[model samples]
Target chain A: MSLDIFKERGTPLDRQSFTWKDMVGEPYSKLDDDAFTRVRQILMHGVEQESCRFKHFAARFNPELRLPLARIRRVEHHQATMVNWLMPGDQSTLETTIGFEQVAIEVTAHVAAVEPDPYMAQIYRFGLLEDFDHLYRYAALMDRLCGKDANNILQSYTDVMPGRPTSVEHRAPEDDLRLHYQKTRAAPLTKIHAALITGSEWQTRDYYLTVGPTFADPIARQLYAEIASIEEQHVTQYEALSDPSETWLEKWLVQEATEVYAYWSCYSQEQNPRIKLIWERFLSYELEHLRLVRELMQKLENRDPAELLPAEFPDPLSFTSHRKFVRETLAAEVDLRARGYDIVPMDQDSPASIAYRAQLNAGGSPSEAVAAGYHWRPGTELTDRRVRDAAFAPLSGQEAAQ
Target chain B: MNKNDRPTDIGINRTGIALSPLDGPLTAEGASAAPPSSAGSWQDAAMVRLRYAAEASEFGHMPPPATLRGLAKTAKELLKGHKANVLLDKLGERLAFERTGVRLYDGLIVKFEANGSWEGGPTLEELVAFRSDEARHFELMVQALVKLGADPTAMTPSADITAVESLGVLQVISDPRTGLAHALHAQQIAELADVAGWDLLASLSETLGHTELAAECRRALAQENLHAAAVARWLKAHAEVAARGELEQAVAS
Candidate 1:
């Protein structure tokens, strides 16, 4: 059923009423494996919801909305963290890491396939390969450091193979910016897609930034640092797609509407009752947020709130595997590089080539170290020989010229 | 509460009055009377009335106002309460979960292939890549279990739970009537959960001082976050297309 977020009244808690102890709810364990999906539903709902909320807030000039928005944001932020942290104490970090990559590989492939904007799709595809390569690198590290096969965590669903070699993932910062979509002409899905991806990539970049330094192993730390930099590039690429013309008020309205859409999607699709409750409640909260923002828009901008969104809520987002799409993209576009507002073959030079040179000048590249660490390993290479050979064919020619 | 009256010092300031000096006007007349200045833009008084209704209502149960600091504390508590053997058992469950993922993707690939090409749906080749990734994950989980001195194939409680949980997903995909859209919805749910599961597992391993394992999980976590992003985007795009089609049909009729 479609959630009329404008009409729904939400559960309102006193600001900062709950303490840390209250927030620490029971986590799911192996016995609760079925519930993990529910947990994911709840967490994703919060993540997507907050992303919409934040985009709106980022555009606001009113210092008055700031305090309330900040409070709401804080609560939403906590909810996301709680949802993510709900795993039982026994799950290994490495195992969960595999799950992370699995999500990345499958999700990216699906998004790229469905992306309406060709340029946006290209960005997704490019980032997909880098993440694909990361899975391979981490799998190698897992095997060497802990005597674990990458397949153990991955369940062999995703091939632990190289996409774009991490060694070459580094590029000039300018290369990250692609052609921007016109805010007025861009599909609502396109706008949301940019917002959604930016949030996730930023999360990954921040995660690596925070967690990379804590690793005891020098190589592991280096790998994270290298991949983390690429995530930064990804954030840059995805965020650049958003139209700069959107007013704070316009953005706020969309954010609220997007949250309602996401929560409604999760609430409807969720199988588990307990998790459904979370989705339902949060959906209500977002509806309230949407209503408030809509009112704010009406009072301030004099534009109908309904005009900011589609007549109906768009389809709910899902996370299914799209192996064929990824494989095709990998084969076809694995050698492509981001040029200004367009993609070009890796062999072709771009204006950002100077940025690459500057990056090289900064010594001790982590991606190279990770690549060097795994080059000698016999069977651990995740990429199939044919795909790997094809991807690196141009690079070999470059080497020959040198 | 009067506009001037402020709430007592709680964890976060919740006074009805605007906290910042830059706050334009709390009153409707004050706001509408003033010319539309860019710097003086604020929420409408009517919007504030809505906030008051939410804040004053006592009938419904709202989620706790959880702050980042509160969550951090909760995480620390969780880590403090963790045990090693329990972690190992969870790892076994994770293995089983990955195995189930492998099977689910395998089934999806077959379905995609058999169905042939659709207008906007993912190609069969994309399904293959996803399936391969799941298979790789399954193998990785198995190896992790072995390294931890656990039998991945053995029927442990966690393993059993994993199997049962995945079975529900497989059941949906296996049904002949399940459309591509429905199948994708189910898969998206699974991927979302999988990402969270990994996040928790990574944190747990880190807390238990499994540095190497934690690092590996962090690497994997980054990718899963991307996966979640991609699937969400696809679902939205798919829905929008469907919605537009429905609109077109209605107009044509």
Candidate 2:
């Protein structure tokens, strides 16, 4: 398939077909030989043997998008109410200001550990950019209203922002890096949860494209499909480093379903009038996105949409959370590996080392051939028995797929 | 003047005008046990000391102003002694939220999806929450200063003016008519307008640095000042009027 053939044949359907070529780029070549080997192995003995079925869920507006939008709204409205309250008292503007230091620290940290891929980094930057704009806008608004530059005074805290990216590894073991990040008595649970949801979204974007072709809404389908394809690229990039066995499709499904539920559950308790309005609007949007994805999955399976709902995710919130869950998952990686599942990285190490170790352990023997499959220069035998046991055990393709 | 000798027409504006100047740093106990101040008007002695915290914040000891060097210094400062840790630990929660405003401000200004809304802002409610946090700090500081006896009756004299000298730059750009004090005065009027019912002006006296100068007194003084300025302008006009009086009539003839 040369460029001319694609140019001539390129309708939406043609584009859909072109996605695989675009993604893998003329498969069965060295460019994807390693990925192909891993994918095929997982697809055949791993996924195909499993009775994993996707059911149809009807297309509906997405509900999860509301969470972020509503949160933005709530923060805004609260500022106004606070201003009105202050007018009589001659008090300085209070409500319009947000905690800048925390946000800066979070952004700085995120940018630092940020997987170092262009696309992923770009999207993350976009999100951070939006968040940054929100912070400054709030500051300016406060300054204008208060007649004093309270925003500048308030933002003075960022002056204390860590000048350097201090990783957990770089800091002395006795030194608490958490304090360096912030003096927060505790991480605000809401922010922690939001971060987790974001991580899940990051993971899902890649996974969703595997089944993007079958959607009914041209706009929704096309947008998601486009995003999904980009996401697949991201997943591949990540896969080269960690959790090589998990298909992009499985990761998307898990992330999407989990995120939808997480956002819905958290925002469910919103009582503020502004928060309630935005939450409802956002919830509707996410629900629709969820429904569209589920229905597409079901259509692909040739099943009733009602049956597809379960496959789409009857309970999406199961994956709700942020780094705490990631931390938990990391901590339990060894135990999970021992249970014969190809797992996420156990600690903060180069993805190459982690992937090589996991792959070697899965081969069941410390042979140079298996290590070679990991793309490692030969001779690193599996000294860790735990890794060996988890690697060689009878692993399910579905387990690998997820 | 004796209470009765003060004219009743002036209303309660005369009530605390003669009260001695408020004075002092807050008691050590109060400083140590400072309450988590609400996001509003200056209220008590403890809040006044928080002004120093705010001042320190301005110099880059805290968030937005923080640089790597500043943060390292702050960390070092915070680690100076067991007592310093106590101060940092106690204030850290509020401080974290304070920094959140810095980060969130970025979101509110530039990237908000203004789509058909006023200025494409976050709803009023969100803004209020953010503002309230800031207001609490300001109010706490003001109250603390008043509690410590910074004069509410008048801007502190020129020597004391140095305390407010940093704020003098504000005078250059702001209108003198509705300068900081008048702006504060207007804010009080607006707050009390609906609640001329709350007698909140009086309630706020000790807290507002108004123990000797209530809102009514401020408004009265503002009126007197305006009257005096008007009279001076009128006198100048009369001088011209008298001089031109005969000439004007002659011209008309």
Measured by TM-score, the strongest candidate is 1
DockQ of 2: 0.01
Q: Give all TM-scores, in the order shown.
A: 0.53, 0.22
Ten residues in a row with the worst lDDT in model 2 chain B? Answer: B19-28
Candidate 1, DockQ to 2 decimals?
0.01
Whole-model lDDT, candidate 1?
0.59
Candidate topping lDDT: 1
The CAPRI quality class of candidate 1 comes to incorrect
Instruction: Compose the digit string of candidate 2's lDDT tens values, residues B123-215.
Output: 445434544544443344344333332322232222122223323222221322222222222222222221331133334433433344355
| Residue-wise C-alpha lDDT for candidate 1, range A86-148, written one tens digit per residue | 554434455555555666676567667777888788888888988877776676566545555
Candidate 2 Cα deviation (angstroms), residue B232: 21
Off by over 4 Å in 2: A1-252, A301-402, B1-253
CA RMSD, predictions in order: 25.6, 28.8
Instruction: Compute the lDDT for candidate 2.
Output: 0.28
